[model samples]
Target: MPPIAILVALADPTRCRLIELLQGGPQPVHVLAAAFRISRPAISRHLRVLKQSGLISEKKFGRENRYALHPGKLAPVQRWLAGLLPAARITEAPAVVIPAVEQPLPKARRIPKPAATPVILVPALAAEAAAPAPAKPAVSQMGFDF
Candidate 1:
């Protein structure tokens, strides 16, 4: 199966761009950050995600960390995509037919539904329902009540 981590890592636009940048050659975090409008920390986070997915490798050169692309990590993804192509599909073998014995299904027991009971309102509630609602105060065009 193709590494799902690679797909997850590539899902982000920042990470995708980071991969593209690394393709040319290994670059330090500050050099990669210079290419983007986002903060250096944000670029570092994207690089971290790519590293976790095994799509890129980090090498320390003195004080600076350079990230390089590992193209072989994408082989599984390529193979998985190749399988989806029309030409990659193999023809299926002929299926053998075997007659199955049929058995009658048992009848399901039916339960009678209960009739709904009528709702009875109390005298106090009925009186309240009969009373007219209070009229709302009239408001001017400015929305202020007199």
Candidate 2:
């Protein structure tokens, strides 16, 4: 909705390229990935980010998943651009001023940081010293020990 948010969404290079590709028409994930040098999984991840950002939308049709540009999600972006630069400056113009389809925004993902080393208050020797030793079993003075 905000200009900064839109800019942040499009900041990723992969996402920018994805938007460019979707401009052509709706395409399957495999087709989109095959067009790029990166692996399909990588492309899928990029698409996931783009989808989360509301730049794209996906649908399952039969055996394939199709993705297309969602202009509604990009309204804030176009509006932001329109403010900074005049509409006439935008070279590529589609029939609709902006597609009204809803763009799926990506979820807020948390990236886990590396685990820190645990600090032990007491030394191993000190711990052993603090522990009680097991008592020896008492046996009768007999030839066979119990």
Model 2, 1-146: lDDT tens per residue? 35665566588776777777788789999877866666898999888878877778899999999999876677677776677778445444663322333456678999999899985656767788778999989777653324
lDDT of 1 by residue, 1-146 (tens): 66688998998887887887777789999988887777998998889989999999999999999999997798777777777785775443333323233466678999999999998889889988889999999656663234
Task: Return the lDDT, model 2, position 10.
Answer: 86
Off by over 4 Å in 2: 85-146
Best by lDDT: 1
Give the C-alpha lDDT of model 2: 0.75
- The TM-score, computed over Cα atoms with residue i paired to residue i, of candidate 1 is 0.58
Off by more than 4 A, model 1: 86-146
Question: Candidate 2: TM-score?
Answer: 0.54
Clashing pairs in 1: none
RMSD of each: 24.7, 20.6
